[model samples]
Target: MNKLLVITVLVALLALSAESFRVPRQAAAEEEEGTLARITDTVKSYYEQSVNTASNYLESIKGMKLEEKAKNLFEETTKAVSTYTGILQDQLYHIFYPQN
Candidate 1:
């Protein structure tokens, strides 16, 4: 008998408490709108940032004058050729002279 009474009271309390926590439809809709706006703004910011970075990178690369690039390339090539020629000359002299 005591267990039965306890079950009945618990069921009644659960029914009463359930209605108090219900969210109003208007409030739920407002929250959803705010979340959507925030997500859209975040995505738009990322796209703009990416586009700006790419534009800056291209501009910097374009700023490199062709004359400067060619000068740098010629200097590096000359250095490499000189080193190779020196090595070949040493090898030939050693073979012909056969120093003891």
Candidate 2:
């Protein structure tokens, strides 16, 4: 009877330990998801800002001198394209070689 009781207690303890381990695992997963969400939001904001700046610059260009307007448009378009392209390339790189 004593042996049986010891075995039962051991089994119960093992079960409790196993259940306890899950909480940390779940928390870690939640933390990771939160971090990913923040990163996604930041990237989205960057893209939106870049787009807004480009649009505003183009819209305002009509009032400027022809040569100056052309130069401004070229500079703004180049900068926006480069910024977005860099973001795309980084995403592609990560997709192709995901970090473990």
Candidate 3:
């Protein structure tokens, strides 16, 4: 009778330990799901913000005249080229005409 009681207690402890292990696994599964949900939300938010930015940019440029755009682009290009050439010329002058 004492042996049977000991066996019963051991079986009960084993069963309880098995159940305790499952609780942690269930909690881990829930935590993983929560993390996934947060990641999905963040990605969706960035996607929405990107779409909004593109829409705003397109709206702002929608009414711009092609000729005006071309003129602005040309002016910017000319300034950049002039600045680059000036720098090059100065470097070349210093190299060839060192004021020693």
Candidate 4:
């Protein structure tokens, strides 16, 4: 009867240890999934902001009267697009080539 009790305690301890290890693994997977979801949301927001900015600029240009003013708007839009493109390219490059 004593030996049976010892065996039962040992089995219970091992089962508890196994469960503890499994819990951390499940928690780690959940944490990783949440991190990925946040990253995806951030990237989506960045693209939406970029799109909205470009659309607003285009809408503003649609009401111009003077040729000189239109030309200026065109130049400004070109500069803005170039800047945004450069930033996006850099971001993509960094994502593909993370050092750590």
* Best candidate, TM-score: 1
User: How many residue pairs clash in all the candidates, one count each?
Assistant: 0, 0, 0, 0
Residue pairs clashing, model 3: none
lDDT of 4: 0.68
Worst 10 contiguous positions by lDDT, candidate 2 = 17-26
TM for every model, in the order presented, reads: 0.40, 0.36, 0.36, 0.34
Q: Give lDDT tens digits, candidate 1, residues 1-100.
A: 8546655755654454454466755555445444445555565566567769999988888797767999999999999999999999999999999999
lDDT string for model 2 (8-94, tens) is 755554454343334453355444444445555565566567769988998777656778878999999999999999999999999
Answer with 1 or 4, whichever has the higher TM-score: 1
Question: How big is the RMSD of model 3?
Answer: 20.1
On a 0 to 100 scale, what is the lDDT of residue 21 in model 4? 34
Candidate 1 TM-score to native: 0.40
Rank all candidate structures by their lDDT, best first, as comma-separated numbers.
1, 3, 2, 4
- True-structure lDDT of candidate 2: 0.69
By TM-score, is 3 or 4 better?
3
- Superposed by TM-score, candidate 2 places the C-alpha of residue 96 at a distance from the truth, in angstroms, of 0.4
